[model samples]
Target chain A: AQSVTQLDSHVSVSEGTPVLLRCNYSSSYSPSLFWYVQHPNKGLQLLLKYTSAATLVKGINGFEAEFKKSETSFHLTKPSAHMSDAAEYFCVVMLTGTASKLTFGTGTRLQVTL
Target chain B: EAGVAQSPRYKIIEKRQSVAFWCNPISGHATLYWYQQILGQGPKLLIQFQNNGVVDDSQLPKDRFSAERLKGVDSTLKIQPAKLEDSAVYLCASSLSPEADTQYFGPGTRLTVL
Candidate 1:
């Protein structure tokens, strides 16, 4: 079984400040991880993914995440938060088999304050 | 390339009413998935399809939900006798293949069961 846990249900940050959203996972297989952002009334957009290539993965909109195996974590980070960055972010784990299935975390709602 | 598309962006119905949602994935994609996202929560996979065949429906509420993919292209999900708890956004995502890590999502159909 594979599952993801978002440590923070909500995170508030001032514009231009650093942003961090913590996530952890449990999986039996090697596991493929992903970060997705959802703007209100919009579909989910893939931010980045870790497929065993790099420990630190860079995504669009200046977002990035580091996969830490020892910590069982994949925390998303942005150098600076922008008003446009305010959205709900989800951590997902992909389970491999005959078909791949994704398990999502509860999500972290990032609020960028002016 | 066009992204995934879904019909009936929003729907409201009383308890026990039946509702269905349609999804058209990206062209040439062979894997499709259905997910349910409750307000303030993450998306949960309801079913997955490889081509027109079902790969997984382990998390689907079989008693109330059913889904089908025709010609390995468009797909439909139906809910019979929906409950108030069924109020959520139904997301449809597709990947190039089962092994692909990235899944492009549609805007989703929000269903509210009063």
Candidate 2:
């Protein structure tokens, strides 16, 4: 079984400031981690994933995440935030090999301000 | 590549009514998924299919919800006697395979149960 926890339900970041969203997971075996962003009335878009190949993963729209095995964490970050970045972000986890099922965290609503 | 496609962007129904949502996965994508996302919450897996075979439906409300992937290319999710609590956005996603741990999603159908 696998599960994910998003540390925050809401995160506010100023435009041009750094953005960070924390996530943790519990899995018996190695797990695949992902970050997805959803704007209002939009579909969920894949941001990045960590699947044992690389500890640091970069994605589109200036987003990135690093996997920490020791801490069981996959936190998303952005060097600078833009207004377009304001959206709901989700942390999802899949089983090690099969990736048959995905467990989603109770997403964090990101608010970017000027 | 074209992303997943879904029909009826929005629907309104009253309690004890029925509703259905359709999905067409990306071409040649063998794996498809259905998720329910309530406002302010994350998307929850409802069902999954791999080439016309059901992979999982543990979280689906079997008493009132039924889904099918008739041809292994397109799928449908139906909810009967929908309750007020059933109001949510139904999202469809597809992937090449579970091993990839990457999924592309559709715009999703919003259902409001009055």
Among these predictions, the greatest lDDT belongs to: 1
Q: For model 1, how does the per-residue alpha-carbon lDDT over A1-114 read when each residue is reduced to its tens digit? A: 799999999999999999999999999878899999999999999999999999999999999999999999999999999999999999999986668888899999999999
Q: lDDT by residue for model 1 over B1-114, one digit each (tens)?
A: 999999999999999999999999999999999999999889999999999999889999999999999899999999999999999999999999998878999999999999
User: Model 2: DockQ against the native?
Assistant: 0.75
lDDT (Cα atoms) of all candidates against the true structure: 0.95, 0.92
Each prediction's TM-score versus the true structure: 0.97, 0.96
Which one wins on TM-score?
A: 1
DockQ of 1: 0.82
Candidate 1, residue B22: Cα displacement in angstroms equals 0.5
RMSD of each: 0.9, 1.2
Error of 1 at B53 (Å): 0.9
